[model samples]
Target: MVYVKRALPPRKDNGQRGRVFIRRAPLNRKLRPKQLLSRFTVLWVNTAGVPFSTAGFTCRASSTGGTLLATANFDNFGTAIFNTIPTPTARTLVIRTFDADDNLFRTRTVRSGISAFAIIG
Candidate 1:
């Protein structure tokens, strides 16, 4: 078995001999969306029920009150991790998906707590 390690970003007191440390960022309570459902995962898939992994495919979510919430790009597995999702101003979110050419693929007015906003083709 093998595990990988990554170099932590340099700190103010870096180079104190060879000792290093990583401090986790303090959790922001306000950033956590109030989920009406227990859905904490989003998976983008195609019409055939397969994960869609097309390049340049992306999703942008904004609050109905005109606040940008999250913009996530699809990964190789057609999964997007919203590392910094914040609570939306309204219960509904305006989520838009774009294609490889940067053209609008779909627009979905979904609940702020919806599991996924998918663009299947």
Candidate 2:
């Protein structure tokens, strides 16, 4: 089970506002099970009880181990993506960026954890 909690800013005057984005989480280890992350589903939540648009944005993830994952250029909104891959072994996952310029941006390490499936269910 994966969950992301974020606090978005209030709406602005130019009809622009913040957004809550979600994508597949990436696996960190190299020896882990090979799972290719290709699709992402996104939803926008309003904390200030205001409506917003979900256009003009992109969010995605890839499981190439060392391959770079990039997101579209976001002006004012916040984007969040998640990945779920079997961790057969410990590995390092890199989260790259193409937001402004094509370059490597972020990286995270993932390791095997105790199964809490029963607790969540």
Candidate 3:
């Protein structure tokens, strides 16, 4: 398994100020067999001081390449209080993938050029 942190420009949208972008791809046919890749599952978290909203997050995956894009929400709450006052900060993008056996196959964290914003916002 491998992890990579890309140097992307900071996001311009206020809702995505601390958004972290990640692209996951199979290393090779031998290292990451197609059978195992198909059974993989992804999970993420915010390691920075800010907390993700209860509204949840969104992820987009490619059917052919076995690649995925996961985004964390900074302020995704639906309540009135949280809607008006949002917490935007330098958040960390922690991505983890597990195999069929539930064994952790890969883990990575990106701290730069990230923001905490809601997927809907």
Candidate 4:
């Protein structure tokens, strides 16, 4: 009988370090609106401010059903991405905002601003 052992490089004491190992896999395909029926995120960015308005904003499909999915708020003007587990049949995009008086306003759309918007495997 023979026993074999593999040794790894010793860890460096330096506080800064790079990734030791990473699995290199092809990027996953973006989920579409129909596919989002399962659970997907809605990312949006409002340049103006909360209680959003017609000033316009952009949105993207961040991810689907997992830890990587997180919601975002518009501090100034940028990008927002996230995911969720909404009802498949209830697939829709809702944009909402408020005014100085706390007046709430929003809009809904069947199309997402993502490049792929709604594509399915």
Candidate 5:
């Protein structure tokens, strides 16, 4: 599962506002037998198709599906932010799953092609 939360900008009357929360359901859609996931990786790329950063985590399967063995924060920008020039741009998210034996099982890529924007400042 993936979760993301961001603080909302301050309201005109209220100092700081609430937060925007997002969570992803378990990766069980169209799951196959013996296709247990052991590792998960997410890569963030710019509109130019240049990968800026990647985050990975280990998984442990259970009856419900799987749970991340380590704490993974999508907000951990690391070197990605410093390497990029901040501007109005779109990004792509690449999600990859691996099996227990370290074999990649599935891959999904989502592209936010610049049409969507939530302006805060």
Candidate 6:
């Protein structure tokens, strides 16, 4: 869970105008500390002959042991940003994609490195 403070908008109120506090819960429990989390980038797209877009796509990563690493949504550029606990050596991961309605659409095996990665799913 996290708390965010934002300035309150001006309105006719009996109390003084100040900041507002909003609380948000994380979608999933973090697997590692921020310092140990590495980001991976993946691009999901339509096939060469298929006319489609990767909009409203999201994905999650899991260890071969079946532990979920992290989840992220695709940006305008069709890149799914993933953060996970990385190993010193390359490791294999199971990455699954979902549609906007959270329906599972695709899955792929990825070999993870220390930096960002680009793979088509």
Root-mean-square deviation of candidate 5: 20.7
Q: In model 1, which runs have C-alpha deviations exceeding 4 angstroms?
A: 1-41, 86-90, 115-119
lDDT of 6 by residue, 1-121 (tens): 9999999988778675696878866879565544343556667655553323667878888889999878888876677766554443267878888889999887788775544444543
Q: Model 4, which residues run further than 4 Å from truth?
A: 1-72, 83-90, 99-101, 112-121
Ranking of predictions according to TM-score: 6, 1, 4, 2, 5, 3
- Over 68-99, each residue of candidate 2 has an lDDT whose tens digit, in order, gives 44443322433344334332323333333333
Model 2 misplacement above 4 A: 1-60, 67-75, 80-93, 109-121
Off by over 4 Å in 3: 1-90, 114-121
Please report the candidate that would top lDDT against the real structure. Answer: 6
For 1-121, candidate 4 gives per-residue lDDT tens digits of: 8888889999877765664866665678664445433444332334443332222333332222222222333323332333442434243444333333545443334343332122111
Candidate 5 pairs with clashing backbones: none
Q: Which has the higher TM-score value, candidate number 4 or candidate number 5?
A: 4
Q: Estimate the lDDT of model 5.
A: 0.34
On TM-score, the stronger of 1 and 2 is: 1
C-alpha lDDT (0 to 100) for residue 33 of candidate 3: 25
Q: lDDT values of the candidates?
A: 0.66, 0.36, 0.35, 0.37, 0.34, 0.69
* C-alpha lDDT (0 to 100) for residue 22 of candidate 1: 93
Backbone clash pairs for candidate 3 read 17-115, 18-114, 18-115, 18-116, 19-115, 74-116, 74-117
Q: How many pairs of residues collide in each model? A: 0, 9, 7, 8, 0, 0
For model 2, the local distance difference test gives 0.36
For model 6, the run of ten residues with the poorest summed lDDT: 112-121
Show the lowest summed lDDT stretch of 10 residues, model 5: 78-87
Superior by lDDT: candidate 2 or candidate 5 = 2
**Model 4 lDDT, residue 94, Cα:** 42
